[model samples]
Target chain A: MTLKIKKTDYIVITAILVWGLVGFWFNVQGAGAAEHKYATIYVQNEQVAELSLSEADSYEYSFDFGPENEHTALVEVEEGRIRMLPLEDDICPRHICSHTGWIEYTYEKIVCLPNQIMVVFNESSRGTTREDLDGVTY
Target chain B: MQPTTLKMRNRLNYLTYLAVLITFAVVIHTVEAALPLPMPVPGVRLGLANVITILALVLFGLRSGLLIAVVRSILGSLFIGGLFGFGFWLSITAGVTSCLVMGLVLVFQKRGLVSLVSVSVIGAAAHNLTQLGMASLIIANPDLLRGYYPLLLLLSIPTGLFTGITAHYLEDVTRRMIIKSGPGAGQ
Candidate 1:
């Protein structure tokens, strides 16, 4: 028996290809640049603090979700990049956030789902808050 | 032979075929899971078990295909101890969504509007989309759909084609086997 390819098959494949390409283009465009100048911290989807990446600093922040649920994360900014160290006092089962080492790109982020904390980088001059990074971080 | 007896035997044969297909799907799933992923992206897989599901769909019917998909996913998850968790929910949702989409495609194929490869591609894409949607909801992060969704769609093409070819061959071989073995060979 001979396998036959139909016009509809080509159409569907082309559609998927175009969609994926457009998505990839938008993703790349949204990334802006690879330069990192500031590190912003968000707790519970709200921006809590912003740190200058030019200066070396290490700090610990605690997020209290409720009376019994509290999580702490160690944020370290050094050499124009930022990293979240594994928190010894975090309640999350896996320390995946801490293991995601130094992020310097504008679109890069370190997210702690259990704590609802997100540390993301941006260009210092782009005072405009872009929601492009919202759903991109895993 | 009695008509009732022959009908009973046919039903039994189909049930046995379903059992064998389910076992084959579970084994494929387990072995695929054991293989190291080429990428670190979550929810991306070769979906090797889909080969069995598609073959069942083609050889038997929509009901048998759906039965294989549902049973294999649940039992496979149980075997892996992933039942009721994030992975289990994602797999079940994807499996059902793809099964329905593939069934619809099969309907269109009967009219000569689509082909098996197209069905597999659409099914694979549907699986990814369903999983992404479920994952985002479970993680309470709609952001999970941003960059990964497109990548998953693209990856599904190759994987779908591979499974489609495998199913095509398996379907032919199984059909020949069934013919040679006659109606109630196992009995």
Candidate 2:
């Protein structure tokens, strides 16, 4: 097989590699950094209830937050919205998107198993913007 | 061989193949579109129609497989009103790569089934990468992406295994049917 990769293909592969490098670099940078004033929306699985930042890590990552036991909702802050992203889809009957229903928070989430999705609000850093995370190309 | 013998050779039935591929694609798209998972990502999918891509790669060749993929994506988009905008490109890229690679493998190893499995796995991983890259660029959240790596790797392993096995079983049965029904089989 030729070692040469087309420009588009190269872009895809390199982009993935770069994504990892940048993420790694930032995680190291972000470790032990001060926590900001962002809210931590509570989600046990697919159901999302509001929680203080102090209670954020109280539940496990796989906790189900919704009435339906199908998929779990994981919270992540993105662009000032509590995006209720579904982490996995229920293999159960009537494949419902755990995200279905009302969401007041800008970044809300509803996760489904097998299809892991995490939606949360964009955590606003006190004195820093999303750009504070160095190596962040965007 | 005489010129008359050459002239009598039956040409491949391309129209029928195209029709079948398109219809199957439409049905798969309907299933994908009408149904939503418990969780929603703008572009993530099970890629169920890819099973057909594997089948085509093994039985026909790269060209037919590519044609089927393109037709499927285009028609699938029309039906769903193109909910997956960037996802369209990602799937097309993954489909093309998988079909071509699998076709080359079959040419060298004569293992169409195995090739299908590998190709599907590759497609799943590539599809994930495509979305991840876009997220990094557009969403401006590095931590959000870093958080996804473990899940992607974990999801890929089993999904790849299952999809490959399914494609393998389907290809084996379909191949037998094709052989038994083809013009020279009984004779």
Candidate 3:
């Protein structure tokens, strides 16, 4: 078994480890100290809606989605954090978006792949540039 | 043993073995999809079905491994009722890509340059990267790849290690079983 641990194998393993570490470090740093002030919703890569987040403003919003708009996603915001309400229609088979529970940080994003919907948090002072959270590399 | 007769028998044996491996892989894939992980990560899974793929590759060859990967992904998606959906596309693309990667690694393994564990690790990493890349394309969001890639890469190491070890032992057990079955068993 030890014989199988050849020089090339070690290089592959070490490269993977280093790449993963760098990505993780970048993710942590990109998510650093910035406060999220707005939650922007994008459908098919277009900004469909934007909601300013604040401790004093809490509300639930429902929007139509899907090819024929046959499905709806209900979003709940409380104390500046956002979450998706589980729908009976099951627009998404996996329900990963709803199961994501809540997003309080700029790094967290609620994405519904089936519906092509994405909800991302933006920093208070940063422009609506999506690349701010795209710094994590692998 | 007559050469032609032995060749035919070996073909029969491989066909039956392929069927069995596909069945095992399908069951594992469907069950894994049904069982949700505690973490909310979008695309992370143990990829346990890969064990059978590696097993087939080790026992049979690249062709067998690729056949199992494609057949199992399709049948498994059918079982889970996700056929032709986003998840199905993601799985098929990733599965085929990784199987090919493992097949390439098999050459080195034969030369004693790498072990089954390395083959599995490379396959797992390829699977994850391919899945992430496909997801990004389908979702039209590069951030999805950028954001969660590290976590997926990190997780693949352990998951790959577990599946690789399992595949190694499974290959041993399966070979032993074949040897014990009879002299007529395909070598």
Model 2 lDDT vs. the true structure?
A: 0.53
lDDT, residue B70, candidate 3: 92
Cα lDDT, model 1, residue B128: 93
How well docked is model 1, in DockQ terms? 0.39
1 or 3, which is superior by lDDT?
3
The CAPRI category of model 1 is acceptable
Per-residue lDDT of B1-187 in model 2, one digit per residue for the tens? 4224322423343445557766886688668767777654344566677777767776677888888877777777767766357556555665666566556645633532334445555555655665565655456665556656545533544455466667778877876776675545454
Model 2 ranges with Cα > 4 A deviation = A1-138, B1-10, B39-42, B101-116, B134-150, B184-187
Q: Which whole-number lDDT from 0 to 100 does residue A95 have in model 3?
A: 82
Instruction: Write the candidate numbers in order of decreasing DockQ.
Output: 1, 3, 2
Clashing pairs in 1: A135-B143
Clashes of each: 1, 44, 0
Worst 10 residues of 3 chain B by lDDT: B178-187
Q: Report the lDDT tens digits of candidate 2 across residue range A54-80.
A: 213333233453446554445443333
Question: Model 1 chain A — which ten-residue stretch has the worst lDDT?
Answer: A122-131
Chain B of candidate 1 vs. true chain B, TM: 0.92
What digit string (tens of lDDT, one per residue) describes model 1 on residues A1-138? 556778998898888888888988877776565233777888787887888765344454344443455444567777666787776544656877888888766667899887777888643423233455665544
Best by the DockQ measure:
1
Q: List runs of model 1 lying over 4 Å from the truth.
A: A33-138, B1-4, B184-187
